[model samples]
Target: MELTANRSTCIGSGQCVFTDPDAFDQDDDGIVLVLRPQPSAGDELARATEAVQICPSRSLVLSEQSA
Candidate 1:
């Protein structure tokens, strides 16, 4: 799966960082950053989904890989 963040919709909330520090981080301004553009399955996917749910700004998004 692939994770993406909408720069326009982001509001410097660190929820994504809180959920998965390995998968997500924050800029100097505290905006969410995806450490892994293409995540492997298992724990990574779980963390990604958690980040998406916890994001107050709803900036995090998950997209399935195309066949």
Candidate 2:
């Protein structure tokens, strides 16, 4: 899966981080930083999807890999 976050839409609420700290983190300014852009591993994919679903700002987006 491919994951992307729109910084402009992120408010640094940390919901994504709360869902998966390994996949998401906060910058010095408290903005969200996506650690994994395209997660190929199963565990990473799950965490990335969770982060996307839990983001209150709808900043995180998860897309399936296209053939």
Candidate 3:
């Protein structure tokens, strides 16, 4: 799973952080950041997907890159 985030679209709701801190975080300015751009295709995938869905501002996205 590949994770990407748009800091400009974040609302500092911390949903992503709460869902998967291993894959997402908040910067000092309260913007969402992608901590793990490409999480292993494992348990982290589910949490990452939830984080993307729970983002109120739709700042987080996941892509299934062809490997």
CA lDDT scores, all candidates in order? 0.85, 0.84, 0.85
Off by over 4 Å in 1: none
Return whichever of 1 and 2 wins on lDDT: 1
Candidate 2's residue-wise lDDT over 1-67, tens digit each?
A: 7788899889989988888887788999888998877887777788787788878899988887677
In the range 1-67, model 3's lDDT, one tens digit per residue, is: 6788888778999999988887787889888888888887678888888888888999888998769
lDDT of 1 at 38: 78
Candidate 1 TM-score, true structure as reference? 0.88
lDDT of 1: 0.85
lDDT of 2: 0.84
lDDT of 2 at 25: 89
Candidate 3 is scored at a TM of: 0.88
Select the stronger candidate by lDDT from 2 and 3: 3
Superposed Cα deviation of residue 65, candidate 2 (Å): 4.1
Candidate 1: residue 15 lDDT (0-100): 79
**Which wins on TM-score, candidate 2 or candidate 3?**
3
Each prediction's number of clashing residue pairs:
0, 0, 0
